[model samples]
Target: MAKPKSGAKKTTPAGKAGAKPAAKKDNTARLDLIKNASKRVAKATTKLVKAVPEAAKVAKAAVKKAALPEKAPEEKAPKAAAAKAPEEKAPKAAAAKAPAAKKAAAPPAKTATAAAKAPAAKAAGGKASGKAGGAASAPVVPAADRPRPRATKLPPPGEPLTKREMEQLLTAGEGRGVTGEGSLKGRLVLVNDMPNLVVVGRDKRELTFLLQGPDQEVLPAYVDHKVSVSGLIRKTTNHGGVVDVRKYSAKKPEAEVVEVAPAETEPRLRYLSPGEVSMVTAAGMGAGIKGFASIRGNLEMTGEEFVLVVSNGGTRQQVSFLIEGKAASKGLRKHVGHTLQLQGVVDKTSGWGGRISAETVEPRPSEARAVSRDEMELVHIEGEVPTSVDVKLNHGLTVRLPEQPGFTWAIEPTVAKRVGLREANFEPGPNGGPATREFFFTPRNPGTFEVEFFLAKALTPGQVDRSFKINVTVKP
Candidate 1:
């Protein structure tokens, strides 16, 4: 400390000992450039700690490449969950050799939420072993997206068997057998060269089958509804039978409006005349009636013949008789619905349309006459029709009928407006055995009117095979 004083005090102790060896020789190159910039920030934090676990193994190999379409149906798993195949190929060979620039630093919403939890943990935990952040991975199901097996064929061209297959069309003898566990109730057809699923029964019989398990999406929404199925029956082909469907129950009926009172616009029958009831059992069973007449109505009996319906206003007639005695057939069923007063005879020579032949049936006091005479013009009769007739004014009412070997009688010009036609013929018989027609009505205006007839096979009255009514009453 005393050597400086002589050099001009060596300028203050020789500038503090030559400024400590040149500021420690320039802070030794700024602490060796901050120790080589802290060794290049410790080699960029050790390459971001080795690229954040190689970007989480390239985001678990982009969620095992979005579960390689469900691991190619993992050979349909289940061999005891595919018993240890090299520990499930060690995390799919480390996620298929990860390194695609670690999926640009991973985390795209955690690789789409681990790509939807590896197909619901391979469908509720089964083919497990998939662990890059495992939640029981196992998805990779792409053999063009699974689900194809039931095939044997027959539903293309107006396709119906449940839109060409979904499991109900097992073709091998393509149906017409298997049926005997019984339970069908009707309707549901699809026929047109069936493939399987018919039902039509209610005695129409037709059973076909195959709509099992979940009833193939529930019995095709009841095709033509009215179902009632009830499983197991297989007869394949003795004309038909196949019902494997199980437990069914549908319905949809609603439409009725019948009201047949004295209304006759067709459907008003009284057939079976076997040659006019053997000519009324040889003219004696009908007691061979003839001239005098006085009928009235309401006495029914039909089967062994006794007729007499006679209503009016809305018209109705029916009067077949032969009342003999023993007190007139003892309690003649307490006179059915009394209102009688017959005293007949009018068998007008045959087919018995007026069939009177009575001889006493008294219960009168209900007489309400009103048919102003006009006398005959064509007044004949024949082959059935007499429950209580009594026509007159504008006469000319011959009827005759008798042909029926397939059919022919027509008259529905909007319901023969109370009889007006006037002429028609065809007698030929004795040789052909069954021929006879005549119809010639007249009464255009009277109180109790009616006059239908239908026996179809074209003449256009349609559908009523053998019906004939004549509820006559035309009087004044």
Candidate 2:
């Protein structure tokens, strides 16, 4: 080991060289750090420059999205073309999108907010694209200009109706008739002077149908003739279900034929008395002979049947009759309370007790007198009277004769008897009014009669009214 003096400087090759190298290393490190920092700043600035363009693109997209609503005008142009033809719709839609693409390329503003709104702008653009496509693809037609479907008529006879067609016919409103095909085997009868075809249904039900044609000439020839008719069933206001005949054909006659000797006979119409009609009705014998009968009675309805109550010698008997026509039914109901004379053939069957096939029904002759108000006043009767007065048999008439306050009146009994007056009453004068007399008399028979009233004397003097006469016509 070498001994070293005190306060001597120590020098080592490695140390000296190492110290310089360390200093150089430190400087190189600092330079490398500065270079790295500069590179980072340049990279950051480049990135910022690149991001500015991207943000501008995003802003352009956002602006385009904001302006999407403004493209409504372009969208509407396709509507006109769509109305003309559907094929031109695609070209119109493509034209609408070109403007949006051009607008998106030019950015409105370069900002962070624009970048943030990029996603929303893209979404809005997608929606606008879809709306534009939809508007162009579909064309709307005005409802008023569209052609309507034609109505279908009913099928002809022998052609079965479909389910849908039958439903339509059933749902048709009242007064509308549905046509049907069926066999109508019946006898022809005159109702209200109009020909009608009476038919018995398959269910053993009787139905009367009105016959109408060019002149109703088709039905009369078919009397007692079996027929097959195609008609329209309708419900009337008064008459029950009636069918209007449209077409009819006669059926083949019976095949059975037997030779028999001809016997001479004549149908004699015998007049039926009330007692004979009553006995026949009670016996329930079917229509045996053609008879003539006239009965005055009131009409009453029981269920679907109409009954005529005839009063003969204080005895009331019911006679039922089936109304065959609408006019007859309506007239019967109209004149229900009035006295009607029915002339018809009396028929008795097991089903119906007693019925009359009435050929004619009319109101009975009225035996009553109608006196006008002016005529009543001409007889010297005072006060307001009815416009028209009806004097019937067993009905009395009351007359009020007016007189002055100081006048005395006298009625002759002999004149009253001649006038068919049963009794007469005189009422005293009221306060501050003229005297009044009331006469009541029941007419014995139908004739014209006159009564005399004499003014005997007047206490007031100078009033000389001698006598007056009143004429009254009685009726039975």
Candidate 3:
């Protein structure tokens, strides 16, 4: 009312114009307060954002410091643990290497003789087991399973020879040229359509005997009374091998010679004629006086006690006697060329050489037993005569080798006309030095044979010189 009087021109309610202005001012102040608060909040958010990185850096530094171990034991714990891990693995590794080390040392230790015992015993047992395995694995080769030849020329069954008779026959010769002589006394019998004389005794293979007389005489004697013949043991080169009577005496006590008629079933020894002998001059001898003797050139079968021929190299009448019941030998120098009279019984028909038994070998006043490896000085016991020899090669040649040799060789026939080997069959062990070889060979034909020896160049220079003396034994 007082304000309205002052103005007087316009009058308005107190709630209208003044109230509108107050409301506007209140709104403006409220807006200003809200704006100020928003500003403060924005400033606080900016400060917080700016401090976040510094806080994080401080936290990181604290974490790093906290992670570091302060004590020596604490710091060393991790390193110790790491070392222990390797140690744990190392034990297993060492355990594995232990066996390897033992294996490496085993070979040398086994050479100590004492350590070899167990292994050797195990090896022997293994060998025995292997033998058993081999026996089981081998295919049976029975008599029935054996291969039958298209033509088999086997001798017919004959009477058996006796042990006492064999002993007596084998023990008689002592002097030169079958001085020893022996005989078997027995009744004659017919076997497989063949006449044979036999004695009763048990010993050795081929106990059966054969007839030493003509078929007619042997047949009659076999059909009639008991017959006994006394003579030196003569090896006949027929029907594998057999002994024949070199000098025979037929009948009982007093002894009588029965005229025999030749027949088909007679033993070849019976009809064989006495071997011829000839004398020769100037001959050479082998290194030893009684070494192997042979003719200068190849000769056919003479069917005599010993063939006589002129010496090829030296000057001396050499006498060669085909001595029965003795092993043949090679490697001689002095006796190679010789010519002399042969004093030994021989079967001309069957090419046999004979020897008397030891009982029949009685030494004369001038003769004495010689026991020496070198007997070249013994004159009475040594003579020069042409001889026939069979060269023998070792059997077991084509076997796998355990180790390589310095030299190798092949065989060649230098002088032998009748060679007993095939090409690519065998290789000698070495050259010049001691050469040895076992060979398996297929014979060209079935017959009494001989072979010469030679060497071929199968090695290069720089290899040591090897010489091999092949000692061959011929089996009849």
Candidate 4:
């Protein structure tokens, strides 16, 4: 009687255990489901997302209270069954397809989904997949939680492989962890948030690698440009690799270099002012005729324009004033190469040694004293020496300079005023000789004076070709 009762009690428990699958639709299983929901929601809120903690707490409390009667048996049963069920099936389906098919659940998703949608969905996905996997003929194993078969440990990376081994491995598609040195031709590209070398391998299959090196910065400049890379290469994935670049070069044309002209260094052009006119006039080498200076100086052709030679602050500062109006220059045109006092306005333009716009023209009053022929003294000039001369105060003076072709010898107007000029005569040189011009003058006062004559081109008067000076002493 005791044996049968014990047998019956054991039978009842076995029947109850087997009957739980049918009970999945029953009220007890439903309550257990509610408990599972409570746990998942609490984990999702408090542990995973940590969002809506209060709501999760309220839900857990309500579900826990609802599932109190069934929690002890129902909660422990599923977990125990999950643990024991895989052990039973793992040998039958020892070739686990779950590793690949369920690998998605293995890794963490890098980019998060919308928070409101992800937490509950994620909890449901993780918890539900285990249950669903157990039901399928594929056997139950959450890829992340599966006990992996012990693999044969590979040797530590030794020497780099040969080019032939690399070629064969690429063709075989089985070169999982081989290292080698080889040159690869490809277009540099950005992929998977990293710069990669993409090359077409055996059967036109594309191989990719995450590029790394000191020179990786130059990769962007070579994008879409054909490049050759040589270095240590290692196979990380079946068709992918990583290469620590030892060398790289681009098949690109040389960049063009442009030559820029040097910046302008010429000084700015400016006006020659009337203030300089005051210096010449104050020196008695010029005069201010009706408020216009330089009127007393000789009109000479400096270039194409009329210029008045005048002394300026004891320096060779030349002033050129252009005739601004045609009517203003009418009186001055006939006076080129002559000395006179003329009323004019001096204006400026480019490179006319000078031209004054005159309103009226006149012959200047001679300041030379009358001297008779008996008092005249003739002078001869020898080879460029003995430049000093002496004369009686009331006696006439003559100075001469040899003339040559293609150039003209003229007295510097300012220096000429030191020896008052009353007459000038050109004497033709003795038969077939160069001509000589005699400059006859008298000293207006008894003092030492310096005289100068210069040779210059007809077109460029601003430049002097050659000049000579003489010191003359006049004694009373």
Q: What range of 10 consecutive residues in model 3 has the weakest lDDT sum? A: 377-386
Cα error, residue 284 of model 3, in Å, equals: 75
lDDT of 1 by residue, 247-297 (tens): 678787556679668855743224324454334423223433344555565
Residue-wise C-alpha lDDT for candidate 4, range 357-448, written one tens digit per residue: 66665656544534555736655454344388887776776766665553445565666666776554434455536656566777777889
Q: Give the TM-score of candidate 2.
A: 0.19
Best by lDDT: 4
Q: Number of the top candidate by TM-score?
A: 4
Q: What lDDT score belongs to each candidate, Candidate 1 first?
A: 0.47, 0.47, 0.32, 0.53
Q: For residue 206, what is the lDDT in candidate 1?
A: 54
Each model's TM-score?
0.20, 0.19, 0.14, 0.27
Tens digits of per-residue lDDT, candidate 2, 107-154, equal 321222243244335434654565555555556655685442321233
lDDT of candidate model 1 versus the reference: 0.47
Tens-digit lDDT string for candidate 3 (434-462): 22322223223334543322222121211
Runs of candidate 1 with Cα error greater than 4 angstroms are 1-202, 209-263, 266-476
Write down the RMSD of all candidates, one decimal each. 24.5, 28.4, 44.0, 28.5
